[model samples]
Target chain A: MLDMPFIRIIEGLNHTLENVIAPEVESTLAKGQLFAVVEILKQISGRFDHKHELIVEDIQVSQQMLTTLIETFTAAAIDIPDEFQANTETIDATAMSGEQLRQQRDRLEIIVSAALDLLNSHRAEIVDAQKVEHTVFMQLGKNLFRNMLLVSQHRFDKISQLDKED
Target chain B: MALADNSRLASYLAEKLGGSELSISKEWQNTEGWSMETFSLDVEYTKGGNKIEQAIILRRQPVSGLLEPYDVSIEYRILSALQASKVIVPETFWYEADPAVLERPFYVMEKVPGDVHFVTQNSDPDYRLIADDDERASLAEDFIDNLVHIHQSDWKSLGLDFLGDPGPGKNSALQQIDYWSDVIERAGVRAKPLVTLAVNWLRTNAPETDQVRLVHGDYRTGNFIYQHSHITSILDWEMTHLGDPHEDLVYVLGALWRSPAPTDWVCHLLSEEDFLSKYEQRSGISVDRDKLNYFQLLLDLKAVGIMATAANAFAQNKTEDLKPAAFGSILDLAYAALAQHLNERLSSC
Candidate 1:
């Protein structure tokens, strides 16, 4: 599992809270929250197992979109500056670790974002601006959908369970 | 050091109040919120030949937080200015900027009875649950009333001109953009194409503000205390600043803060239409849809900026608390929400 190492630490804390702290705790608030911590830890441990895959998938999607954004701008007869052309290469997700993948994706996103900014600023002057905007929106929609899917998979309801003691 | 414990705090307060016979009846540290260390306590003391008791809450800046470091005095000043305003806020007593008083700067305010209800993620029994329809309705009205009062107040006349006058006209929107942009840049998170696009969009379509009022930058649910279905006090003014009123309205009406309730109540109390209409009717300011949309994007960017800082703090081991780490995990969600909003606005444009 991607989170195996971190999961071990969480498990250790959960074990201590259950066996050590909960037994010695006097106040119900502290006791209940300790147990809740254990529950949250368990949830996080379970979630982290697949989080690397999710990250990898997101990176792959972003990389593809970065490439597409460049192509779309080119197709729209938009001048691609030399600096903005940097890091337009496709990233091989399989060869990189999750951290490396994130780094690579972040680098690629920076380039694409510059391109987006250029396009947005010059959009009014472009005759086929709608086409360019549509392509950018489509790419953004892919990322947004991926993000929503991943977030929906989260087991912990941060809103409902976070302020119980307040 | 736990300098805010019961006896130590009681001793400090006794001296501050110019009294001798003083004792703490209750004291406890609140472990919520990643920004500040909060301690709620009750103090009983003899003052001017009379016995008196008061509940008080103390807030201190932590060693590490989710935003740029700030002095507690700013919050104190804002609260002090609002004391005579229609905005319902707790009474402030003292502020200690010197780190010698405690490990960090701290301020004390009245410990208003009632608890902030965060129904989305917590099930704590301490918060007063509003099951009665009548009570819920009453709380909603009060919530709208407070917000309107804040937006309508003459902040310039309240001696709050220190909060940089965003000049005249649309300087409010531009000023807000500059402020959040600086925060996001300072956060030093990995740049995302989405945030860049959103920021540009904000700049491209910044709105004009006719009036500049105190914008409760974090005006949403979980920031207010309620008792008997009444909002006792509006809390957490650390992010308070002078800006467009629509900014606060956008925060209140944002989708991110919505509960799972039917009609998806704005703050688990009022419907969106009701909230907007009540605000307009009460404040006498018409709701500007374009301004709201622009500020909503700004708010989303602010959320991402904060998450970036939290994530950076945790990744750097600057804090051991899990709250910042937890907040970090939601960065993706904020990004997605921002991207979605951008797509919607751009597509329509």
Candidate 2:
């Protein structure tokens, strides 16, 4: 699940271009280009969605990390909160839609984050805390590498050009 | 608060400057800035029977942006206080806080003459930011000297105590962590485990600083203006505050502003060794590698906070500008970098 849906992004782009930016265009070529962009976005509005496999991969990694975290806490005699364990157990990604899987991933990541915070607070009590932290970091590293593949290169130069003209 | 047109601005300037036949010759809002709304106004007027022309910069608080709870007055106050210091800054004219004037708090200052250079990953390697080696060296010296002046200036004497000193010891580091943490919470973005892990690591490993000096929070190459190999003005004081000097140093050495590959100069001006040594020698403050490491993580956290805030602004429909939306969309990129760094650092520790 994307934070802002792909449809909403397209709609926003079209709305801003047509209503806000188009009226301000003075050059005919720029105006035509802007309208062409709006038209193209409209055409492809429903043809695509964020990759489902990426969300599934994120969920799997998070689940594995949480499982290891629960085991580490169990071995250390640290009380794992029932809420945390319940969130960990609710990772049912199978047969779920992309949106559902994304929500699951987001929810599980929040729980995992809280669990890490809990671990930090109890670091003095846990045996080999560094080893446990290192384990979580490595798992997070995997997720990060996968997530980065989805990020697009920033077009700051293009943005700067628009700014100069505006 | 909608002072949207040039005519309204011209009228306001006429009233403020006590000039007659005033008109805005040229005016444009600086769309490159993501935080505050910056507008350049070239005005022609008559005062005391003499024709006057001036280029003035007006910075107004934005409705929502990367740094929110917007207040243009703090920047105005900082620039106002720094007028007599050795630091090169634009001349402040007046600050108008009443909403009746511009529909938001705004300030006007002399539009310093220069070009603000931008260095991108795709920029040519040989001529990334400054082409001439001598010009680059000159700019590097001015950059280091200005930073030293900023860190060495007495905040209290300069009446910059309003920025709230983050007192001695580890308070500087801890204060910044808390500050940026609050920004993240306010942005209300989804939790990423990496951010939490890094925050925890930062808190657990925060170093101490006996001296608290003025830190230009966003100091780097792009934030300044250069003319003929000289830095005419150091801009963007919105993030200025009192903190450990190392915070600014770490920020200057961030990878975001460096020249691409073949020449990995810090801020595309000088090497890391040169920056640190010059800063240390000039300010008489010893550079701490451990503190630099800690602040590096903190800097990453700060970037995450800014991006999250930008994303939140767009997500909430606070503004129609798509820049925030684009910035928000790239939050994952920052997370990936932060996660990789944390993995390396935590494993070594």
- Top model number, lDDT: 2
List, residue by residue over B190-224, the lDDT tens digit for candidate 2.
36777778888888888888989999999998899
Q: At residue B337, give the lDDT of candidate 2.
A: 65
Candidate 2 — which residues are off by over 4 angstroms? A27-47, A90-94, A162-166, B1-3, B123-125
Q: Write the per-residue lDDT of candidate 1 for residues B1-349, one digit (tens) a residue.
A: 2455557767888998888789987777775455887887777899999999988888888766587566778888888889989889999998988787777898989888887765353233333335677988998998899988888888888888888888668788888778777777766643566677677777777887887777888887788888888888988888888888898998898775565544477776778998999889988989989878888788888888888777666555566555665676667777776776777777777
**Which whole-number lDDT from 0 to 100 does residue A28 have in model 1?**
96
Query: Whose DockQ is greatest here?
Result: 2
Report the lDDT tens digits of candidate 1 across residue range A1-166. Answer: 1112466546655665687568878999999998998998899775453345666655665656566666766766778877555565455667876557656656666777677777777777666554565566576676567666655444233523453575
Consecutive 10-residue window with the lowest summed lDDT within model 1 chain B = B119-128
Q: How well is candidate 1 docked (DockQ)?
A: 0.31
DockQ of every candidate structure? 0.31, 0.58
lDDT for B66 in candidate 1 is 80
Itemize residue pairs with steric clashes in candidate 2.
B1-B103
